[model samples]
Target: MSRLPAVFATGLILALAGGAAAVQRLPATPEPARLTGWPQPAEMPGFGDDGTLGPAEISDLTEYVLALAGAQRDEAAVIRAVPLYQTHCAACHGLGGEGAEILGTPDLTRRQFRVVTGPADIRLQIWHGDDGRGPMREAQRRSGRPHG
Candidate 1:
């Protein structure tokens, strides 16, 4: 007989016993702390009273974003987009869309895109991020880059 099996069994038993003991030590009813001098929730500046955009406002903003995507070649839009892209996307996608293979970022300069079909598709991807790939979606979400 090997000592390895006995050692493994003993370790597992000890781990289970430890977990059970810890669980048993937990309080059945947790006490809620009395509210002290914490600041009450207040309306934030620049967010209206509710901190949200209405449906119509959201729709209009989405339409405006779509228009901007469609007008990427327009001089003013290009100027605005260039800085935005550099700030938000260049870290992963590269400054010139060359992509970073080590980070699994895809090249964007290619004529044929694997994911995007049109301006709307690009906008959706920008807003939602890629699910099949890395943390692009989560990164966009954390950055809170205004999609609309």
Candidate 2:
């Protein structure tokens, strides 16, 4: 009976030790880099006959824009969107979201937009340009570029 107890304890210890070793050997999940500024991409998405921005990218960019307009910021999403804004919007909206009068793009840094009232409105603008300019969606579909 005493021998049985010793065997059970030994088996428990061995099982625990084996589990610890297995845990040590397991691969760790990679952590995303700590981004202090915007992330830059090697290649920008092309405004080809098909729209370049994906659904996720548009969501991230919208969140980032809201942050720029003084809304609650999603730091991670904002960082991810920095390069996207530079490549896609900066040409007309300017780096600071100052916007261009000639291009008829509205200033994004302001809290109140002439056309955009909320997130959906911003997404609509991204998909379709403002009234002064031709619809970005149709232009991208037809010519692979925004028609200012």
Candidate 3:
């Protein structure tokens, strides 16, 4: 047998032993801290508007809205809210909630856009329109939709 084989085998054994020892000496990673509450933005002023809907209604409608946005699923809720969306949202938001860029409406299908972060932010937008001020507010008020 050539001495080359023996040298290669010794080097491989030493490398394996060194790697194992290094791994054994490594510190254990600690578990990440658990979060206790909703994100701070949801609780900020002028952002957490739950609107005129009752808690149950809000929850159900939120499920429906998120579903329309392609973020969630609740067939019953979607069915129930279809007419409401058609009446109130489809005008500017588009029938599929794709939004109208020329009209400055943000696409609802996306999970986040501008001030809208989640359901709470969506609720605020639904209640207050885009900026909680100006023409959209007047339009919502004139249309008899909740504008707070």
**TM-score, each model?**
0.41, 0.52, 0.47
The regions of model 1 sitting more than 4 angstroms off are 1-72, 133-147
Estimate, for each residue in 1-148, the C-alpha lDDT of model 3 and write its tens digit: 6899999999999999999999998779956544344222121122114444444444555676699667657788778777767765677668887876655565767643564445665554555444434223434356554433
Query: All models: lDDT?
Result: 0.50, 0.65, 0.58
The clash count for each model shown is: 0, 0, 0
Q: Which candidate tops TM-score? A: 2
Better of 2 and 3 by lDDT: 2
Which whole-number lDDT from 0 to 100 does residue 43 have in model 1? Answer: 16
Model 1: residue 49 alpha-carbon error in angstroms? 20
Error of 2 at 23 (Å): 78
What residue runs in model 3 are displaced by over 4 Å at the alpha carbon?
Answer: 1-60, 132-148
Query: What is the C-alpha lDDT profile of model 1 across 42-121, one tens digit per residue?
Result: 11122112334433333333343343434344355555456555655666667776665555555666522344545544
Model 3 pairs in collision? none
Candidate 1 vs candidate 2: the TM-score winner is: 2
Candidate 1 pairs with clashing backbones: none
